[model samples]
Target: MKRKLIYLFFLTGSFIFLSAQVGINTTNPQGVFNIDGAKDNPTTGVPSAAQQANDVAVTVGGNMGIGTTVPTNKLHVNGTDPLRLQGVGTGNSTTDPLLVIDANGVVKNIGTLGALSIPSPAVFRLETAQNNFLQAQGAGGAQVVPMSMIKNSIPGLTYNAGTSTITFPAGTYQITFVYEAQHNATGCTISSYFVDFPLNATTSRIHSTGAHSEGALSNHGGTITYATTLPANRNWTISLGRGQSGNCSGAGMNLSATSTQILVFRIGD
Candidate 1:
């Protein structure tokens, strides 16, 4: 009977131990928490050492390296190599860069440029003027001297009497004319040559003159000189007429037939 009682006691202790173990299993999820190698319940919710190391190795998004870094937008690069884009070929060498557009885009490597257009035209015109002399006197025959006469006397120039033009096609020119008075034994006064711009009738006048003794000879002359800028094309013209002086007489001394007048024209830039 005693042995039977002892056996019952042992069985009761076994049941008690089993019930306590079941309660601990149900209540304690981690089985046992540790701090400095001492057994205790975890006061703060913190991953164990093993769990923390695993988290660092396989981060929530991925590895924290260049290629494995998390992307903020659709177009992104791996953390392993920042320059490399996702799904692009893998290599250290740079590939043809893809143009990335941001909220405010950027333009690069554009060259300098200049504008172009057509030019405008300029305006131009021609200018003309005249210079001459005229001499006349009361109660006597008159004479008119044209600028052309002097210009023709120039050596390389060809004078056109009818057209009152002078042409210097080849050589240079230095021409001059002057008028001097002379007294005649028959009481006649010589007329001095003069120049006049026929275009202006009223104001046409003669240049300064000098008088000389008669019975011998009295002559007057003027000068006109110029160099041909263009030897190939050169022409000029002038006109001549008799002068009126108080003692002048056309009967005794007549103006020479070769003594014609002329006009000069020059063109240059």
Candidate 2:
């Protein structure tokens, strides 16, 4: 009887081990190596139900998904939480830098947006009021009489009232300076010159009117014109003078508001 019983017991144990579902924490495992336990890797003596399911897969490459089973890209992220990239280390000294990759595979932070460019349009003008003039008197030789008022000026041009000068951007420019001047010098021959109009650092002749006679005063007026290429980012001023030739020793020159004016034109680059 003992021999027969032992054989039956061995047979029963063999059938259970081969046919029954292999499980560790529980009597039955839903799939191979469930999260809770597995046949090959089991809970040992611990007790817990294995994971409910398994897709039978492995991470073939670097890309892996979180909160997702089927990852579409490397380190794919999912779920309801927002993702963000953070900066590390000092951007130049504790200043956090924006992330960027260089051509040589170097990451760094840069100050400033790079270089800047300013636009320059051709064809402009700077004109003063017709009443603009200098009260120049006591003529000895050529004298500089600065234009006093600016009615209008082009963009990128600034006029200084204290210096009577206009500063403009730096570039090669075809500029022309015009001046309308008048003098009221009694008893002597009167002449008008454009000081700084030609920008010669010397007086350029505009127009001259001879005296009528002694005690006979008449208005004398004329215009000066000079054109050429000028330097950029420089200050320029146009002035009107009287008795530039030193002929009107005893007479004085006055500019008229009705006829006196200063006009500057930029016709080329």
Candidate 3:
């Protein structure tokens, strides 16, 4: 009786070793290692594709497949919701990229690119309303151009009508200001116009148009554009007035001028 039991055990171990395949809930294994999760695989022959839906397979070549018998890649999953990852923190920034796939199907982050990417710009536009005039400041003097209406503006900018100022965040910005006006007094003329805005606490950039002389009741226009990087968050005083070298003293300009426009665009941080 002992010799018979030893012979039976050896035969069972030889069968398990020689088969070179293992199956759970299945007698006919489709891969080197397979698990029929639903226990509905066919008792004989191969299971249909529908019956193989609830299955996990590991091929002899070390390819793993979830819900598939034949995997094309190292790890292939064939389901509507195939894979999911958990425990990913909630931090997202340009410096720390989330996940981006390259042209060759390789995953990468911003750190791989070795540069900090800039975000899209925030734009704000302010225009004069009907019957609105830009306040006329004499030579060497500047006054904020009051914006009566907001044509189109984005967030992150604060506009105060009473102060006629805009608070800007720390970033590189491109500012554009344009205005058209005519002198109201007879024999009054302006040699030039300029824009004054604080680049920083100690410095202010002036953009002046060249020689826009106009007689009384003569219409004139000026456009100034400048780009600068601010080191800190501060208020920008958008002022349009006559330059110091102009003959605009004792002359009223911007009378009922409604063609003023101010555009502030934040390019990058």
Candidate 4:
């Protein structure tokens, strides 16, 4: 009886050492370490590709694989929705963390969404009103210029002809306004003009216009560009103010051909 017991122990030890592979729920091991998650692996020879769908394997080089017998990377996963991460909070703000893939195909979250560049298509333009005139007002007074046409505009921008106002959406924008004017009266001279919006009272600047020699024939223009961020929707307008003589005539100031051009484009949040 002692000889029989010793022989059986030697045979079991030799089988474990010679095979050099461990398998759970599978007699025919397909890898260095295999787990038949569904107990569907074949009992005879190597399992087929279909049977490997229910198997997890680890290669001799320490590469692990799910739903596949061969693992080419450190952690290879196959099948639909093979990987999922829980407990990650919602990322809805610009300061929220973001997942990015590196050049080596490794996943990382080293930066926030604000650090990335995104495409934005928010732009607006109000232009092209011929025969529009700016009535000359004396110093310290202003006359709102007329913009009758909407040459180009997008959503988030609205124009009201009744109020002579333009409503803009909440965002940071680079705004540019250009105008072409000429003196219509001999005695009147326009020293300055401005593109004004109530929200931009402090930042808006007066553009200088040199004296015009010809009463109605002389041509002059000014352009102003400024950037601002609006926390909410706001209205904007253009006006002629600052350094104007009372002698300026009614039809003395005229904007012809694409005058009173205002272009606004959103740059950021």
Candidate 5:
């Protein structure tokens, strides 16, 4: 009867061990599961990954690893608050105004915190508007006159004596000329003449025809009148002679007389 009791006790102990082994195997089918490294804990109702042990608690002046509570008064290389430097012109001026990434993944210029110290005489040039002059009238007409014709013995007065063919452009111009004659004796007559012609080669002339034999010498002046529009470039000459049939080049005609003749030309729109 004692032998039977021993056998039954041994059988009970063997069954208990086998059941414990079976339960352990059923709980973790994968053999790779580690009891210490498992995220789930069966005791204390706390997850192994979420709860921190008493020994793992962060102490003063201790560096906190990732997933751990940070210590008080500890310097965080990459903390929530930004790390800033206090000074002026303490960086590489060549590569300064640099945009660097902060601890929070924000990009900002390092130079914005302080006043920048730059070189002097940094010029900022600006361009100004220029004034220009344009020629409204082209090269034609009395635009082509001899230099000798625009002069006078007196300073203010200008005289033109020679014959010049004025080829006008395709526009109308008021042509004027002054003729002065100082008659020392009577019967001295002076004539100022002008001719107007069309592009078709038609011609006209303005002159004075009368005899003056009075003792009292008086200055008589009259202007020539004619208005003809030019269809194309044409030529017209002014000839000043002494007497009728007296050509421009003749002796005793005084073509170079001291009396003045001024040719005034004005252009209008």
Candidate 6:
């Protein structure tokens, strides 16, 4: 049986039922079932803006839309408020303002940051959206730190573990290396200790010297520092060794997790 209930007028709280396309309060139905809402005063102080034309309207059906007939998301807002998200120095300085959503689904502008804190080393690492000036990482042992540890790192530098070399592209750079070193006198006669930055070869050296004496209980410790220009395609290795006058000259020296470590960082271009 073919049936239709069509009303060419607008009304509220009206209902019509049939196994056909029912147009309640209007001659046109947009969906399988459509309701032509009544002409009423809009929040914009305009009349019939809901149906007669596009104005401030709260529409709801399959998808809820604000000022739009075609809703692309669950809640689609078609027009701009031009006032929301307006402020200065938000979510930053101690006195800056912030925009936050409340439990009542109202957006409130507050004069403080959120209460949440980033508790992990890997989270919220950057100080700002554009620049990273300092980087820090802590390790328990004397493990070799590779470039992968930097959450933000610029290019043109390389580290080779096999040769203990750091290669930099032809440019002037200020390199800082800090280390703690100590050697037991068990291997050979103690003379002097040294930490060396050998560029290209051991003969070309930058040295930090320390003192030592003979005894199993005697261990000498100090730091090594160096800075220079690296020609294009040049590499350098940092090393720790006993002084040439010591009996341990041909003997090898090793660094333990507790006894020794090297901290290296680039200060500038």
Highest TM-score against the true fold, candidate? 3
Model 1 TM-score is: 0.26
- The TM-score between candidate 5 and the true structure equals 0.28
TM-score of each: 0.26, 0.39, 0.59, 0.52, 0.28, 0.36
> Order the candidates by TM-score, highest first — what do you get?
3, 4, 2, 6, 5, 1
Q: What is the C-alpha lDDT of each candidate?
A: 0.31, 0.41, 0.61, 0.61, 0.31, 0.40
Model 6: per-residue Cα lDDT over 134-236, one tens digit each = 1111111112322222221323456565555666554443443443333343654444444445343233344444556755634444555555445556676
lDDT (Cα, 0-100) at 56 in candidate 3: 88
Cα TM-score of candidate 6? 0.36
Which regions of candidate 1 are displaced past 4 Å?
A: 1-163, 166-185, 198-203, 220-237, 252-269
Collision pairs in model 4:
184-252
lDDT of 4 by residue, 163-219 (tens): 667676666667776767666566655446555543433345545556655556666
Candidate 4 lowest-lDDT run of ten = 1-10
Worst 10 residues of 2 by lDDT: 112-121
Model 2 Cα lDDT, one tens digit per residue, 1-269: 00112122356446322232223344333222222223332333332222222211113454444433344555544444435558844432112334564664344565322111122222212233333233434442444334555444334556675556666543333343343334445545544343444332333354544444334434455555555444555676544454456355544444444345555554433
Model 5, 1-269: lDDT tens digits are 00112122366446422211111212321111212232333433333335222112223345432222232323223233445667856653333465787765556675621123221111111122111101121112112122234322211222322444444433333444333332323344432233233323665544543333433433433344444444335555543333232121111211222233324321211
Of the pair 3 and 5, which is ahead by TM-score? 3
- Prediction 3 TM-score vs. true: 0.59
Clashing pairs in model 5, backbone N/Cα/C closer than 3 A: 141-167, 141-168
Pitting candidate 1 against candidate 6, the one with the higher TM-score is 6
